[model samples]
Target: MILDTMKRRRSVRRYTGEAIPGDVTEEILKAGLLAPSSRNLKPCYFYVVNDRQLLAQLAAAKKAGGAFLKDASMAIVVCADETKADTWTEDCSIALTYMDLAAAERGIGSCWVQIHLRKDADGNDAEANVRRILHLGDTMRIAGILSLGMTDAYPAPHEESETDRIIRL
Candidate 1:
């Protein structure tokens, strides 16, 4: 079942403008919280945003990407506190994957918007702009943003051949 969900999951960039239910959003967040982390150091924090204005700003935050976020019913900004773990990036990455899978399982379409190391239109850092908008202090480092909404279309299934990178003993 987990494999099935993973196979069906894809980056969904378009939505039908259907509003996601509160309980469903809560479940997705819960899944992120339950993700395994390095040395049990759970440093992930999700900041859920539904404000249209904020979403629009987020869409523009990256000049070349995230324009789709303006149409997302909700966007979850995954961040981590550096003080909480040395492997904060790894921890938040796991949480993001878990949340994506959870959303796919629920039939909600989602896409990831990468923020780290990206730049905005004015040559400002993407993470800094997002932090400013969210009122997050310097301690919090953003991992990515997950844009969510009802499925306008299901993406094509994954082909199995990409296992080329796997190494097993």
Candidate 2:
């Protein structure tokens, strides 16, 4: 059943405007915090954004594109303090995956968005924008963002087979 739940999980882009319940959101965050980290170093911090105005500002500043933040009911900003661990990125990623499965179990849809540390060739600095908006310290880094809401469209099933990607040496 756990595998089935994971199988059902997908990157949902379209969402109903209704907000996710506070308790459910809390549960999802708890699940994320419970995820295992390298050498038990938990460097992740979560910023749960439910305010529409703030969300709009974040969407614009972060350049999420395609009205994702505008339509999603809530966003979870996952950040890491680099001083806390060398593997903060990998740790945060695992936590995000846990949150995704937990949300799926509760019928809430979610999508993960990666944040970059430096501006791209066109001069886009999504991480800097996020840090400025969230008032993060210099030591903190934006790891990723999770958009959550009730889905208006069901995601298609995953097509790739993992059998060929794994090897037991």
Q: Which candidate is the best by TM-score?
A: 1
lDDT of 1 by residue, 1-169 (tens): 9999998999898899989989999999999999999988788899999999999989888767799999999999999999999898888888999999999999999988998889998989999989999999999999889999998697998888978789887
Per-candidate TM equals: 0.94, 0.88
lDDT of 2 by residue, 17-111 (tens): 87788899999999899999999989999999988887776666544452587678988888899999989889989888899889888889888
Deviation from truth (RMSD, Å), model 2: 2.2
Overlapping backbone residue pairs in candidate 2 total: 0
Tell me the spans in candidate 1 whose CA falls farther than 4 Å from its real position.
166-169
lDDT of predicted model 1? 0.91
Any runs in candidate 2 off by more than 4 Å, and if so which?
A: 63-66, 117-122, 160-162, 167-169
Q: lDDT: which candidate is best?
A: 1
